[model samples]
Target chain A: MSPVLRAFLIISALLLLAPLLFPSVYYYRIGVLVLINTLSVTGMVVLLGYVGLVSLGHAGFFAIGAYATAVLPAYGIPPILTILVGAIGAALVAAFIGKPILRLKGHYLAIATLGFGMLVWMVLSKEAWLTGGPDGMVVESIDVKAPFELLGIKIKTAIAWYWICAVAVVIGIVLATNLANSPAGRAMRAVHESDVAAASLGIDVARTKLTAFIISAVYASVAGSLLALFNRYVTPDTADFLHSIEIMTMTVLGGASSVYGALIGALILTSLPQMLTVFAEYENMMFGAIMILTMVLMRQGLAPAIAQLFSRGRK
Target chain B: MSEFVQFCFSGLTVGAIYASVALGFTLIYNASGVINFSQGEFVVIGGMTTAVLIASGVPIWLAAPIAIIAAVIAGMTLYKLAIEPARGAPLVTLIIITIGASIFLRGLMQTVFDKQIHRYEGFSGEQSIAIFGAALLPQSIWILGGSLVVFVLLVWFLSRTKAGNAIRATSSDILAAKLAGINTNSTMMLAFALSAATGALAGVLATPVTFTSYDAGVLMALKGFAAMMLGGVGSPAGALIGGILIGLIEAFTAGYISSDYKDAAAFLVIFLVLFFMPGGLFGMVRVERV
Candidate 1:
């Protein structure tokens, strides 16, 4: 079997079997969050890792997906269709802004994306009429268990959401892996190394980057949609600057260049807060320390650093 | 007309603060191409320290200088502990490191001080000075005057002093500066310290008008960054111009347009300006060698 297929099967098996070790519904909820974050971070791997473009505003897309699900349903749109609508909306927004902002390099690009993210946040928070202001709004939950019930399996809501998110994550990983191995993916990597060189080599550098941006935006949108559906609530906080940073941190912390690294990053960040509830006030401090230490000690991130260690041991 | 004057006063007051913050960014960026995201935290530290000290019965004059000293220490500590250790890392890594430092400092502040919003009495009393039908607060004058004094001092330091010349030399070319026997590392540390001091001074002056809290740094950092970008990165004059422009624009927007969208105006202006002039108003157009 191909490496992609093998990796998929392994991940699928783990997702299926991991639930057996879950102690309660709370763990399942956290599992769902991890998978959602993993899905989003996979997109980060493609954009930041593959194309070497950083976006400090992807939470804007996430918020779009979430708000679409929350508000569109009230307008008689089907809940499931909102996900598709949200993805399309996010894609269009990314494309529209990406053209002008992508021309900026480095700090400029970071700030431009940040500006866009803040604009989205402002609109969501200030337009209380549409988004229910900062208080947020309730999301109409989708019946994920309906099909399973038809099959005579009565799974709990959390378990059903967990399975659904796991399936989404698997699909997301497969697609990302496929992209990573494709000709276009090669172009992205080439751009990541040197956009000038890529351009000289006849690659449409701008087009390639926009493609990555759009794809990543779609992934974030879908992940946001899933989170909204699972939680049955949506807030403007979903698209805040801190949320964007959290997602970026997860992507970089786990090793932005690898899918498995994305998974590791999502798992650790998602669960660390829960474990640190005992020292609640110290949580941010610990997080900041971890980020600094990680970058200073292992700039390649945890996964690549660990991989190197193991390979060196073998040598 | 009076309303306009009032807006202008408020605009200039806030603009002075933003200018100080932007100057901090310019200093560090020039010395070491790292955009210090924790610049606003220096402001917070300055203000918070002053508030805490004053509350503990320290005189205002004593509290203010102590706060500035604390911020300078924090700045040097950040460079030595976080930034220096990550030397030669990628730009993205440096950015994250600074952001991490900001978060760490914010957490430290939250732990060390209470989360309540705090501010000391303005250097002058709370009386409003009436000018052309507008009520101008005495604190605004202090903020404006204080910022000007800091700016003058900074310019004199950069242009007239030996250490300032060393910083300029390092900024122009690190290798060349080192070849000429300048300590680039120490210059960088000095840049960080000066940047922190500028930000802290702004905080000390403006806290009386805007108030201060642990979370206030985030918005200040964002606005300061916007000002830096607006004026053009790495240019002190640009930072000053951009910050004043941003403050004026925000004040006018709040006065005429929806107050809720006042913050949005700065970003919208940035978008428009970047599209037309990527180099900013005073920034030199960059030419890539490659």
Candidate 2:
């Protein structure tokens, strides 16, 4: 079978067998967290892997999406509309900011994105009336739960959200995979390789980059929306600079070039903290050590580096 | 009106602290071409170590030097152990390595020092003297004057001293400097040590005014990085000028604008600077092929 078909076959099997792997409903909650992260990393693959532009502020978009869900329903908007609102809002902000920021390259670009993320964090922290300040605010349950019970046996709410998130992750993976193989993806890679070369080939360099930026923002927004719905509470810390770094760390850990690589990275990172919670106070120390070790030992990122070693041995 | 002056005075004082950190950042960047995000961790170490020693009843004079010396050794060890191994690593790798070092240091500080915040008596006591009817701490004057002195001294050292010339040569062209018989590796190590020392010194000086904790590194790093970027990352003069300007900006913004948005104002300035002055205020734009 072709690569795409093979991937689908694997995904279908995993989705079918997901319940068997879960010993209790809590694992499903963790599973949902992984899927949410996977969606965000898929967004990253489009930008860093394809377009060649790195953004430290994608968390700004993620924050906007999250805050929208927490703050909007209080304004009488329906809970489901929050995701769409968040995606549109994040995309618009990206386009506006990308206008001037996209001109810089390398460290300047990195710092500019960092500034944007900080600005978002400041707003989230300071706007106590809207965001409940650093203490965070409780969100109304997204109530997607109501529809699930009609299917007969009432599953745990975490399981229900896990399935919803898994479906969204599937859709996201398919879209990203398709986009990666499309002409746009090819153009993005060209720009990534050498913008001068891409321009020489008559690609609309700025426009292509902007499209990818906005598209990635959409992925992050969707992920953010799912996270808020699942947690039923949101806080300023969700979109803080450390969270932004955490997202980047996962992307780098899993491999920036592939969605599945991102997925694997997300899964490990999401689960690692929980597992390390058992060790208590050494949690942060272990995290710091693990992050450093991975970046140094697996500089090509975990998935691709492991794959390369495997292929080398096979040869 | 008095409150305004007091705010400005406080802002300038803290700004000098940030400038000291930014200067350290520029020193490392000039020599090694990595951002050295761990710069903040060094500062925290100085503050925490000295505070702990003082708490243990070590004489203030003896405690301060010990703190500086300890941080200097830690900085050098970081270079030898982590940075040296990744000599030819990509830029991103170097960046992440420094971040890792920072995170590791922060973790270590928490475990070793505990999570409690700390402060001690300022060198000249906690008394605030009236300046234009707004009180100014004597420690603030010490910090401000000290940073300016370091800046001027660094300029003289780089231009006039033999070792400084060697560092200049290395920063400008490492291979050429190496060919000219400068031990480029030693120069790089020295740069990290000096830079880390400056950071630690800043921490020691400012701790009484601002207090210190395990969590202070991130904010210090962010402000220092912003100052370095504003002053134009490899330029010493830019660091001084930019540091003062950012300090004033924060002061004015906090005074006039919402305190909550004071940080946002700095970031906004940085974003604008990146848009219009990508090379920075003092930096000349370099042409590199995409």
Candidate 2 chain B: 10-residue stretch with minimal lDDT? B90-99
Candidate 1 residue pairs in backbone clash: none
lDDT of 1 by residue, A65-137 (tens): 9999999999999999999999999999999988877776767667677778888999999999999999999
Error of 2 at A281 (Å): 3.3
User: Candidate 1: which docking quality band?
Assistant: medium
Scanning candidate 1 chain A in windows of ten residues, the lowest lDDT window is A278-287
Candidate 1 residue runs with Cα over 4 Å from true position:
A1-3, A309-315
Taking all chains together, the TM-score of candidate 2 against the true structure is 0.93
Clash count in backbone of candidate 2: 0
Which numbered prediction scores highest in DockQ against the true structure? 1
How far is B135's C-alpha from truth in model 1 (Å)?
A: 1.1
Model 1: per-residue Cα lDDT over B113-139, one tens digit each: 978999988888898999999999899
Model 2's CAPRI class is: acceptable
Predicted model with the maximum TM-score: 1
